[model samples]
Target: MGGSKKLIVCGGLFLTLILSIGATAPKGIRLGKASYRKVTISWQAPDAMTQVAHYKIYRDGTELGSTASLNYTDETVQPGTKYTYKILAVIVGGGNSEFSSELPVRTLKSASFENNQLVEKVVDSFHDTPKSDLNAVSLISAIKAGFEALLGSNISFSVIDENIVTSVVVEELNWINTVTPELTETERLAVQSEIDAMMDSSFAGNSFDHMYINQKLTQLGDEHWGAGNRTAAELFYEFSLNYLSNHESTVSCSLARLAYFAKSHLTQDSSCADISESLSKAKACSERFFDFFPNSAPTSTYAKSALSQPAAWYFSYFPKMLEYSNYDALFFSTAYETAKRLVAFDPADKNAVQRLKRVAAWELVTLQLRFVDEKGNARTGSVKICNVSAENGKRDLFHGDAYVDEREFTLSNGTATVPVYAGHDYSISLNVDVANGNKLKFELPLFKYEKNKLVSYDYLTNSFTETPSSQSRTDFVISSTAYPYNLRADRGIDVFDLSWDWVAPPSFTTAGFKVFRGNMEVATVNKQTVRLPLNNSANEYRYKVVAVDANGNLSSTSQILTVYPGDQSQYSDFFEWMNRYFGDSDIYAGDDPDNDGVDNYHEFLNGTDPTKVPGPTPYAGPRGFYELTLEWDAVSNVEGATYQISRNGTVVGTSSTTKFTDVNLVPGVSYIYKVKQLTPAAAATDWGLPNTFTTQKAHNYEHADKVQ
Candidate 1:
């Protein structure tokens, strides 16, 4: 028995030695490419080993280090130096494996110099030379070019280098520091003469070059003006005037200031006539400046001030159109209108407004009347009308009869009766003497017996055709008593109809108008006049107008105007009707009816009803106390849908229901659920339809409930 036990122990020891040797032996090894900076050495241990102890790393013939991992890296090496590495697997049994295959490594060098040269060449190609070198020019030389380039390039450069270049130039000039010492009379006069010469030369021709030079001169004038060197400043300012005389610009304020200064400096005994003339010219130039540069702040403000000067100055310049036979009334009218424009341009100017009112009052009446001789011949005279009375009993006094020559005059032939207040008598008296040919001449009594009645007389034939009565006249005639009676005659509404006139009849002078339908007034416009509003609603309309005078005198209503409005519904009906006439493609069709994801027709073949909702809920789960997750196949017929989950017919949660989950319910509570699919049409329409699903009751383990 002892000998058998000894043999078994010896065999077991031999088998243990063989297994330990087999476990430590290396099975397979790998060597990566040497080009990479770091190399990885890996080896697999024999299958006979249960666990690996560590891996030994060998660099060339030396052992670098050892780790428990199966792979190792050899990091210590010089650039361009090749080194060989291998890994050895060590087992827990106190035996080691042989080295694996070798890995050769060498470090990478820096990039080539040719790439650096290419980058330098690209940068050099993009760099630009200095502008001065490219153009071969100085600043002043560049400015002499045309305004297009002057304002575009030169001003751009100045704006960019504004702080640096302007400061340098100003420092060199020392302009502010040179204003201390008093100059002798002779020296002052010399400087003033030079300034005047420069200004005169700059304004010799009308050009943009002259304009730029004038601007520079104005700056110099401002400097001299600030230093109290009035004479020099005056010279520069006079140059500005010359520039403006033919070439208007946004810089006329300088000229106006010079004129004002010159006017202010004159003694009281100085010729008012000459001062008036100069002021007139200055005002005109300022006005032109405002018109040319309406958006300029300085010019507009200066123009407003310039226009406020006394009216005598402007009146002195009024053209003597009536005095000279060669001049027409139209010419004087245009001049008056120009002055009115100035008044309108600056409505805040009190002086301008008052002057305009005075001038317009005289001009409006003078233009309205025509003077004639006793034989019914047109005569030229300034015979003005004064103390004219209207039907409302208001009287206005006017400056009259400034005739250039003496002439016997009477009212024009066929003059109609002048309208006046009913039941009132007017006394007409001439201010001329017949005895001395200048004494108070003739007096007559004129009466208006009733309202809306005509008192007609012919002065040329000395005949009384019709006297005022209760009756009204259907045939209209020009009344000598009214201003602009003949003015509206030429402005009939149409060639075929001589009824309505563009210029309002003197009967409707002051108040706005009202349009009435039969006896009812439809619209009342409270302005001086009314323009008919256009209608395009496929309807016809007729309109009539009546005027209310300033004194509350109502005129007879005007004739009617007939017009038709335009149409749109036919275009709107075209789209709807097209589908019936031309079929499906003629009109667009939207998604199918049925809330199912698939179209109605498609669901028919898929064994699913499109109108029916998807599969049952709680179909395969317990009644309660069970975590649940739900998912459904994406529906095609619906854009989006909402889902609800319920327990025992009570809703627990709701979702847009693409997915849902339920958790933590009572052990014996039965639950049921339903899902509905909703489909929506195009954004312009309402939702299409909905489909629904119902689930059976489910219970927890304690209750045996059927799951649907």
Candidate 2:
């Protein structure tokens, strides 16, 4: 029996040794590329006696997940955060290895780069061009080439080649001086003076230097133009365009100026390009500028001059027109209604036809207006186009005539289309009558549209704005009030899965919802639920939801909800500051739970319990017949604290020593005083307690006056 037991023990020890040898930890664990939202960690496969099945990843001392590959990407990461990661390899059989050495990784800090919507809009607008035409292709290539030169180049924001830039500037100056037709003596001196001034200014080898160079060239061009020196003006303007090539609006402005020069002067000189070429270049740049910055196109100084010339010049070149005066009216019509006529008018010149169509589509947008009642039910109403003011210094579209300027439309259904000229602001009123003979009028002011679409209104910001997921829903009468109801939040270890039901009206059909963290949009989804990652460093977070319909109209945002994630034990500071004082009560920063006249924020700043209201303890009495004295215990555990004494609710005086005296008081009269402690240079706390006191009456009067 002893021999059999020894054999069994020896066999068990051998099996354990084998298992230990088969399980091996991952080796050479290192970080791959890390971005703002994700971190990639890779490791060399471990050498195990059995085939490896998978690898396990642990982040910040917890198991994140298992991956079958050697590299794993942890997407649940925040920007500018540090995390510890470790890896372990598991054999195909069953045994797992010990954790690998912990590796510290940090995600790249985030900044405001080019937003996704701008990129999409730029690309989409570019694709709208005639790809087959050589001129169109070259124009598109120029845009792509511009981006490549800026982004693909080795230029660094932190560094610049000053010597090279100085050399280029000197070469440009020399070229300007050696023009074939030398400037007049006065012109020469003036140009030299401007050049000297430009040389005197500092170039800081940064983006500001680029701006300075471009602006100086433009200024020189303007001066020459003002002096009627066309040659010098052309020279400076061309150089300015080259300097501002990467700047969309400024470059477009330069191109537009050159185009105008070509048209006005009909200059076909060796240096001045032909009218068609100049206008074509201007059209391309202006379209790009408007596409990327639709909001700023109306107000931008560059856009005003850049976008105003293309459509008119292109239309003027057409063969046969109804009349020169009717061109504006024809271009303002809807693209769908005018496509056949426009195409037939210039079928041979496809490029011309396309250009006119593009400009017309961009210039005049068909704004869709939806009128609804308080419950989102469609309401029939008349929209009177009361006023229209052009931003680019043009005459108003409407005149005093009701059919011309003061146009009104009846909404047969709840929706109607209005012609909104681009670069113009409008004031329109919607008049709707309710069931009880009551009429409602909504006057919308400073409203504009772009590319036949109205901008989405952000209730959170209470303004017009755009995001990648937020589409233009057109203009609407009923303010979105269908807030998401019965919202529920399920907190995971590092995420919150939020689910809510829409108290949607019958007329509302939800297309998607935008999720926000505070004022920042976190995510957008088509469903009523979203799973959002929580910042491990922060215990509390605020979130809200806004629903969007198929037409892009947004519902009123849900009430801001505050949530605390993870177990309470994780945040020791929260416990020490909040739980220790309030004892398991859920307290918000803005709430005054104790009705102490001080909000929790001030209570926290004052280092007082939010749940307790300090009661007044009368401690003042009369010192003499007409004088009163006040004293109180000083507040403890606070540094540089002072006291404010109030007499009858007015600040009588401030005391640092906790003792104050009131003199010149009427005898037998009571005076109320309130005392509150204040921290240095901070908001004052609530009054602790009110103390009332009366001065001693003059009981023993002098037995006799002067006569007695």
Candidate 3:
């Protein structure tokens, strides 16, 4: 009975194993022929022997349907939406296969090809309005229409689209006519006269093409504008506008042309009336453009470009006009009002912010200056700060120069409060008139603030010896130095462990140490050590340390220590490589971060960065004489890295470079191959997506009838 029980248990284990066997999942599922609204997915059958009734496709975990064909077109996909897909083979008899690897696909976004004609229609509806009705809305519509129609589908300016060749030629003609010094005013006028006569002849029996006439007149107007002939440019622009104003397609171009003509009147003139009239015209056109285009629209960039010129003019002349402010404040006041209007329209404009910053004198930052006596007691003195970044008499015509003059401050209890410009550099000195008008002027190091923050600061030194205040304070006043020293960095696989030495000054306790990478502060640590992650691509790093006392007093910064990394540690472990590249050690073995179809563990074994899309996959092609050649891109970053080539799930050969030839293959046999990058430390690499090629068949020589 005991023997019988042992045999039965062994039989039961064999039956369990046999029952677990099922169909295999589909192989080589990949995208093909994708579009904005549709995507086609194709895959190979699990095997030739397995009777697959159909292949089941799942999108985002929902079963779409089953298809007998090898490819499926997903027409229900939405534009710009990302979807996950997986495939499984349904066996003919009973059990189904496991799901294939998930493929994440994103559909393309729609191009900017719609609703453009609607903008044109809006311009045409208001084209016939009276001069009194030429408000911001009507003018802006014309500008938008003009810019888009002139550029014609090349709004991004990446490439000059062939469709806008006519417009480009017209612009080139205008450029040539203006900059050519050989062309006389009489000669230009004669040509304009002939064009005008031809334009007028169009109403009669014989006429020039209205489009040709319009383009020529506009070109002449642009030439005149460039030549500083404002009156001529305005006359030509008006003539050009009259010809095209009635046409739906050219109305916006006409209006924009006229607006540019008006703006051409702005010149460096002493007369305030001339300046105001030209500025008002430019401001109206620019404001109209801004009001019409929303920030999120693609055309909004053109609007910003339009407004930048006027805003720049405001900045250039505002200060210059201040010189005349003493005679009449109206000049400066008008410029100020224009600035307010521009800011009110688009507060996010960067040019407007710069103009305001320049007009407001400077960014104000309140700084505290501290001092101590030779006895280590609070020393009271007077402080003087010199504006080293400013010129003596840089006056603005409109707004007076608001330079920060050198001033003296009284130090109370070892500290004095003073106001300084944020971005301006300054040199400071402290005077303690103690003995017979004997003044000890401590020459302070120059420093600066930006955006109301103290970016850098250094301690003061006496005139006798230019020693740092930290060391000088120890010799003259304070008893000890608190700055850190002896900073050492130890390189790890993915991190650098930084250790330093710090000794607190007398009566001062350690608060924290600020770690700086170059001039930027990276971290604040209470301990003497910090572990910073290493960047794999960077070969070296510079570090400095500064100590903060418990009383919030900062010491002098330590000497900069540059650390050069030794050997790369990512090659030591797969997880280290993943963490170094992706900043994620928790990534699963099968995760594809860059969506190049190869998973992480395979990527690690192959010596490729999981965060970056890898280069070309392996290629297998059948050569004549029953042989196959396998080729792949060589892995460059990993030193001494080779490739392992496998055929039909078995290791066939190893290559130090990128190519390997396989011989002694069976004729007419199809083989699937996989290639993996192998570093010196890599023991084995797992299989990934496969590439297949069939060997050339040998000619059969045996006779069928057996008569010979």
Q: Provide C-alpha RMSD values for all models, in order.
A: 44.3, 37.1, 40.1
How do the residues 188-249 of candidate 3 rate in per-residue lDDT, one tens digit apiece?
Answer: 33553685576455432112333544565566556656656555555545455434333433
Report the error of model 1 at residue 182, Å.
Answer: 18
Over 1-708, each residue of candidate 2 has an lDDT whose tens digit, in order, gives 332222212111111111111111224776653444556777877765558889899999999999999888787887547798999888788889888877776553322222322322233233222212213234333334333343554322121122332333344434433542434333433653565465445322123323554665565556556656555555556555533354555667776665555556443241222544544554564445455445543334555434444555544432122122233443333222333333444456464455444444325445666676445567777878743454323332222221234678888787777765454456766676444333445455655445534455332233554333232345453444556644568875345788776656778887899988877888899888987765534433888888988999988877566676645466455346655667655454556787878876667666666766642343864366567788887645467777778888788787776678877777679888887776554434557767788876656557622211
Window of ten residues with lowest summed lDDT in model 2? 14-23
- Of 1 and 3, the candidate ahead on TM-score is 3
Pairs that collide, model 2: 398-405, 399-405
Q: TM-score for all predictions?
A: 0.23, 0.25, 0.25
For candidate 1, write residues 1-708 as lDDT tens digits.
332222112111111111111011123554322211344445666566456688788888898999887656555544235576777777678778766666544332111221322222221221222211212132222222322221233223211122332333343234323432344333433653665476466543333323443455466556656656665555555444433444332355664666565555444344545544555455554455555455544335555554444243344333232232233344345445655766777667676676665444333211122323334344332222222233324222112332222222243432222322222234443332121122222233442223444433333223444445455421112222211111011211111111232234535565665665445666666543333323323343555666666887666555444443234244334334333433443111122344535643344334343335454333333223455545444444355555555544456675565565667644434445443334332211212222222333354575454431
TM-score of 3: 0.25
- Global lDDT scores for all candidate models: 0.40, 0.54, 0.55
- On the 0 to 100 scale, the lDDT of residue 229 in model 2 is 59
**Which of 1 and 3 is ahead in lDDT?**
3
When 2 and 3 are scored with TM-score, the better candidate is 2
Kindly give the number of clashing pairs for every candidate: 13, 2, 12
